[model samples]
Target chain A: MTAEPDLDRALVQHLADLARLHLPAERLATVLQNARRIVAAFGALGDLPLESGGDPDLQPVRLRTDTAEPPLPLDQVLANAPRTAGGMFVVPRVVDG
Target chain B: MTELWQLSAAGLADQVRRGSVSARDVVRASLDRIERVDPALHAFVDHRGERALADADAIDGARARGEPLGPLAGVPIGWKDNLVVAGERTSAGSRMLADYRSPFTATALQRLQAAGAVLLGRTNMDEFGMGSSTETSAHGPTRNPWHRDCVPGGSSGGSAAAVAAGLCPLAVGSDTGGSVRQPAALCGVFGLKPTYGRVSRYGLIAYASSLDCVGVLGRSVDDLALWLAATAGVDPADPTSVAAAPTTGAAAPAADLRGVRIGVPWQLNGPGLDDEVLATVQTALATLRELGAELVECSLPSVAHAVPTYYLLAMAEAASNLARYDGVRYGARRGEGTSCDAMTTASRSRGFGDEVQLRILLGTFALSVGYQDRYYGQAIRARELLRSDFARAFAACDLLVSPTSPVPAFPLGSRIDDPLAMYLCDALTVPASLAGLPALSQPCGYTAAGLPIGLQWTAPAFGEDRLLQVAGAFAAATDHHSRRPPA
Candidate 1:
């Protein structure tokens, strides 16, 4: 009965930040406008009632059977690390603990 | 040498089998062609010239010893960068994996190699196969061979362009949405996306798991069929791989479409399609009707929702699949940063292109707990409706035909700023992909400006054999598929 929702610039920027996208500041307005347009275009789905039935299409996430295969050598696994110390991939500590 | 490069895969194989042309000669000609044209096209991302020659020479030696070789023996084919080849860098046209090499070869590539096909090189593609055109590729765009200033469609643009420019007679590509068909149409070649699960997906870099299909680009339907026969089959390694008999034998040469029922959906008859493209498809339909097929006008109202459904589903799947690229276990790693989380964030920020990042964000949002039912769940329901629409249509008709793309290849940067317009280009092709049906794009005609237009034929799941038969019949009746762009 009502018009579908739209995405705003703030929302687009939030998504971009979450995705770690480096969109140029100059292009944000245009990207946001286009994103809004696309979301609006897809709003037709809101008119349909999709809640009547059980989720027949729901698929279970089948985890692969765990096997005790030999692990890769620590050196080989860390070979491509940008920085390493004491045979471990080193990174800046975030948590105080 | 020129003639050899222009020969269809079947023609080349026949000649080599009869000893009229040596395997070495064909490989040499292909390598020479790549050397001559690829510098400008940039179709190939990596070259294994010496290795390809060695493979060809070994095939020739086997032939001399009176040993039989595979059907496509010694023919050169380019692999799209997303398919892993053991010991070769599988970059997916991204700097994130620029130095990363796969320890395993794609099952499809391995099968092609066992069939004696020479690996020409890896071709360019969109970064993570995200964009409609190759402009989003970190390595740069692959130009349309028809008009260098125009674009070859993506994310299989490089493979399509290479086949069009005579860099290779055939190439392997992956289609999600319209990646294979759109590019092949833009470049004026034959591309086929077999029914989902027909080809193994093992070792292919996943973009959208359910939507991705490995496809083939070739100069002719016969060439495509040859590649399909070699690569399509069940693989225990890929659970989605179907356990069905191969369908290559159904591609018998047929001259008429008698008794075939063709459905033309009305939603595909909209204003976004170019006038010339519509005319070309209408003419093809008229010709098919004249040849004795019944043309049924059908309404697929649900098709209007196909593009959005595809995007939401694909982006959600892509977000989940690409979460593995967090700069820790594999691929490009950023220097030590404040924390593991910070390092991954910065690494992905600098690594993925704008389009890839955008989809990842959109997908993550769609799958977020509170929004899941509102977005991702609704999209899935829409996809089911689309599938049911196609299934109902197929019950009344044997095949469905539509224009491969709404418009012919637009200027390279025309829609770069307008993502909606760009996404609309795949409107017609997405319905078939959503339904997991097989589809083929064969050159139908040229635009008034001389760019190529494609006529797409789609069939139900496991209907590739029938689709190929119809396409082969159509190609035989017309010369459009044989017309090459003047390089």
Candidate 2:
């Protein structure tokens, strides 16, 4: 099955990049092929009369009384960090000149 | 000999409470059953044998001391790998967290443990609950108990197979889009996805946050009720959890469905459904009518679009929820890149399987600029329509009925290459999940090939009691649920 040229293989690759996933060239062909089909199927939503009915309000308000509670221990909080230094999670430097 | 593993959760609990059976014996019997059946089934990935026996002994000791115990005093149960057990490896069936351990227990498991249910182990699942078959698990796929060559439907296949094979009396699995119910249907067991917010989602690693719910699978409706009673309640940890009391009373089997109005959706019976499965569901509906239910025709016109809507919305949420899994956190890390972005990309690509990566890409594309309105916005609107459709249908009927899946369990690897075909298997089950209604799948009958066909009953939110009452009535009247898979 031919992927609709309009869906753009490059665009899907850009999506993979945006999602921070590195898909090899071989997998990209299959991903693009499958994604276009899926996206086209999802296009069925266009058939619905979404113009008249406003978006549903699904968000619920949850408020609690301000009360003092014990916090998690710093060690426990840092327990899962892949890299830690000086009592904090260590990530690659963000501010590179 | 009829072993303790063969008894239902309620029976085990009652016997243990009355001192007729010791908890250690029950645990040992379950452990032995696991040893016998799980070799071919691959239902469990982590074995908590020592802890399970210890916990069981504590139950026996507590009984000796005359301490008060909960109704599920000695029931052995499995926790689907997605739910955390303190210090236990909860991979969510993924290689990313294959070695990651949790610092805390999930609220549902904590509740069950508090209620005296013994944790047998962590069951297998599709990685991050993404696939329709257990084949996606990093550990390995769990096979159906009925026929070892077939898949136990997933991503809750492990829990379903465990219960069906008598490895445990009850197990907890999360249903994002029919994860729990689909597997239960295929495996010929009882599975229930409670009202979305009825059960707490605390420590259930997110699949699709809005749709994910912790569900239970068991051999009998009574056991399902008993398991739900132990776990359902609000938790401060889960803001979405509703403030409803746990449903404690198991509905006794009604002699007749005197006032029950069951609606059958005209859309469910279609070319997509297997002939045998459809006929079995029809017979089950006939049985319900014989039991005095008033069957009415109902239409949820939006249900035909459920798969696309559910995938779009769920994948979008999944993409966002899974962003926390960069290499800097608790999961496996790869690539010694100088830049954080490079490291993250490498880690994720190396960590996730094809299915997970595909969804993330699809979700990213849907949420990207210029496409959000056309895809994400429309999916949300479609969800609203589906939810409203269910509400309107419920107004006309006390409950709705449908075949749990369009077909019985397909052979292993049949749909692995075809993503769309696998997604379509969830056609009937997804409407209930997307609507956040309480739905249960029970063994209505089986096919000539000995494959089970599940009959699903769905009720409006918080209608668990009425839902189980009708299911219990049907189960009490039929012998379908009692047929065990051949040894």
Q: Per candidate, chain B TM-score?
A: 0.98, 0.99
For model 2, the superposed segments whose C-alpha errors exceed 4 Å read A1-5, A54-69, A95-97
How far off is residue A82 in model 1, in Å? Answer: 4.2
- What is each predicted model's overall lDDT from 0 to 1? 0.83, 0.88
Query: How would you encode candidate 2's per-residue C-alpha lDDT over B50-144 as one tens digit per residue?
Result: 88999999999999999988889988999899999887788999999988878899999999989999988999999999998899999988999
DockQ for every prediction shown: 0.40, 0.56
Pairs of residues clashing in candidate 2: none
Model 1, stretches more than 4 Å misplaced?
A1-6, A13-31, A52-57, A60-91, A94-97
Highest DockQ: which candidate? 2
**Candidate 1 lDDT (Cα, 0 to 1):** 0.83
Cα lDDT for residue B15, candidate 2: 95
